[model samples]
Target: MDKKHLQTPSQTIGPFFAYGLTPTQYDYEFKSWVDNNMVADIDAPETIEISGTVFDGEGQAIDDAMVELWQDDGEHKLYGRFGTGTEENNRFIFKTIKPKSVNGQAPFINVILFMRGQLLHTYTRIYFADESSLNASDKVLNSVDAKRRNTLIAEKVGQKYSIDIHMQGQKETVFFDL
Candidate 1:
C-alpha cells in the first residue's frame, strides 16, 4: 500500500558540481556526451556570440555559476551548456545562431542559472534588442511591466551580445517560475 511521505526540500547546486557538471572547470574542453555541440546553427546567416556575468544577491560576481541554454525553435534538436570561469571578473559565453520565432512568440534564448546560495535554479530569457516589432508584441515580455522589460533584452556589442544576470536588488533580471 502507498503511504504519505514528506517531500525533500530543494537543495543548492553545491561547490562540487564543477567536476560533474562542466568540463571547462578542470581546464579541459567542454564535451557533453548527449548534446555534443554547444552552438545551435540551424539555418541562420551568421553565428552570434552571447556572453554575460552572474551576480549574487550581494552584488558580487558568482564565479562558479553554470548556464544552460535552450531555444524554443529546436527544429534541429540542439542545446548549449556553459560554466562561468573563476576569472577576475566572473562571466560565461555562448556561441549560437539566431533563432526564429516560436509559436508566434518573439525569438528568445531560454536560460537557467545554477549558482551557489541558490536552492533552485532560476529561469530567464534573452531577447534580442533589435527585434522591436516582435519584442513589442511578445506575450511573455508584455506580461512584465514595460519599465522592467529591458532586463530581458541583450545589448549588441560588435559580434557578441551581452546580458547580465542580477540575482537580487533593483536591477534583478526578470525570472520566471517555469
Candidate 2:
C-alpha cells in the first residue's frame, strides 16, 4: 500500500490584501510598502491623477477591493497600490506621471485587481484616450474587439483621467490572462 498526497485548496484573493498591503487605509499602525502616490515629485509636468471605482457583478461599488498600478515608460518605472475602503464611494486613486510610448507601443499603465471573490488577481491595461494615434497602432490594443477597446481606455476629465472597472455584467472590463 502507498500513501497519496493531496493538494491544498486554493483560497479566494481578498480583504486580506487590503489589511496587509494597505495597512494605513485599514487604520493599521504601520504604513504600506507601496502607496497611491507613484511620483517622487508631485509637481512633475506629467503628473496626473487616475481615479475610479470598482464595481461588482451587480453594478454595486465594492468597498474592499485593492488595486495596483504598474508603469514603465523606458525612463520611469513606478508602482502604486490603493484600497477602495479608504475612499468615499469606494473609489481607488493613483497619482502618477503619464507614461511615454516605449518601443512604439502605446503609453499605458498596467493594472492588477484583487477582490474578495477572485481566486487570483486579474490584470488589465489602461490606455490613455488622448493617445489616439498610438492607441490605433498598438498591437495589444488592436487585438481587442473595437467595441470593447473603450473598456480599457481611460478618459481624460479636466486635468486627470477616470475609468471605472466593472467586475462583471455588460460593461465588464477586459482582463488579460498572464
Candidate 3:
C-alpha cells in the first residue's frame, strides 16, 4: 500500500496567518455590531449553526483554529460585493444565507485557514449544491472528475453547514495559496 503522509495541527511549525492580531475592515462593523447590538442573533430560530472540527491530514483536531468565510447573500453578484475583502478579515459564521448563482455562474465562497504556528495561508473555494449544474458546467470544476469535485462542497446539515479541511497529508486537497 502507498504511504499516506499527513500533517497534524501541532506539527505545523511555520508562520500561521495571524487573525485578530490587528483590526481588520470588518472589525469596525463587527465591533459596532456588537456594541450597538447589531450583531446577528445567532441563537434565533432562524439562524443556522455552522460549526465543525478543523483537522490536519492526520485527522487531528485543531483547537482554537479560526475559519474565515466569504460568500454572497443571495443578492446581486454571484459573489457578494459586501465582504471585507483581502485587506480586511472575513471571518464569519457559516449561518449566512445560501447564495444564488448569477449568469449561469456558480457562486464561489472564499475561505482562509488559520492557526497558531503554521504560517501557511491556504485559500479554499466552495460552491453550493444548487449550483451543482453550474459546477457541471464550470471550466475549472468540470475539468476534474465528479468525485474530486464533490470534495469542494460543504455538506448542509439542517441549518448548519460543515466542511473539514486537511492541511497536509496524502490525498490532501490543494487550497488556494492566498
Candidate 4:
C-alpha cells in the first residue's frame, strides 16, 4: 500500500494570523504587503480618509480585528488593509479617494472584516451618507430594508468618512453573504 499525506482540516479564523498578515501592526521586522493607504499618490485632490472601529456583541472594541477596503471607479482600483491593533483606539483607518459612481450605482467601498472568532470573514459596504440622491437610486442599497440602510452608510465626520461596524447587537452592521 502506498502512504499518502493528507491535508489538515481548516481551522477557525484567527488572532494568530495577525503576525503574518499585518507584520507592521504587530511590531514585526517586515512590513505587510498592504498597509491601509490605498492611494498611490497622497497628494491627489480626491484623497480622503475612512475610519471606523469594530465592536463585538457587547459593544466592546475589537482590538485585533483586520479590515480591508476595495473600491474601483472605472479609472482607479484601490485596496487597503488595516489591523485594528495598530490604531490607538482600536480603529481601522484607510486613506483612499472617493470612488465615483459605477454604472449609475451609488459610489461605495466594499469592506471585508476579519476577526478572531469569525469562522469566515464578513462582507459589507460603506455608502456615503451625503450621496442621498445617488444612494436612493442604487438598486443594491435599496435592496436592504429601508430601516436598516443606515447601518451601511458612512457619515461625513469633519473632513473624513466614518462608519462603525457592529458584529452583533441592536445596531449590528448589515453584512452580506456575498
Minimal lDDT window, size 10, model 1: 32-41
* Candidate 2 whole-model C-alpha lDDT, 0 to 1: 0.89
What CA RMSD would you report for each candidate?
3.1, 4.1, 11.3, 4.2
6-82 per-residue lDDT for model 1 (tens digits):
88887898776766777654455664442213554455567888888898889988888878887757564457877
lDDT of each residue in 1-178, candidate 2, tens digit only = 5788786765666566766788876889877788999996445776799999999999899988889999988788899998899788989999999988999999999999888888878999999999999999999998998888999999998779999999898889999986
Misplaced by over 4 Å in model 4 are: 1-11, 41-43
Tell me the whole-model lDDT of each prediction, alpha carbons only: 0.80, 0.89, 0.50, 0.87
lDDT of 4 by residue, 1-178 (tens): 6789796754455887777888886788877888888986456687788998999999899998889898888888888888898787898888888899888999999998888898778899999999999999999988998888999999997679999999998898899978
TM-scores for every predicted model: 0.85, 0.90, 0.58, 0.90
Q: How close is candidate 3 to the true structure, as a TM-score?
A: 0.58
In terms of TM-score, how similar is model 4 to the real structure? 0.90
Model 4 poorest ten-residue lDDT run: 7-16
How many clashes (backbone N, Cα, C below 3 Å) per candidate? 0, 0, 8, 0
Ranking by lDDT: 2, 4, 1, 3
Model 1 residue pairs with clashes: none
lDDT, candidate 2, residue 173? 95
The lowest-lDDT stretch of 10 consecutive residues in candidate 2 is 10-19
| Model 4: per-residue Cα lDDT at residue 32 | 80
Off by over 4 Å in 2: 1-10, 41-43
Q: What is the TM-score (0 to 1) of candidate 1?
A: 0.85
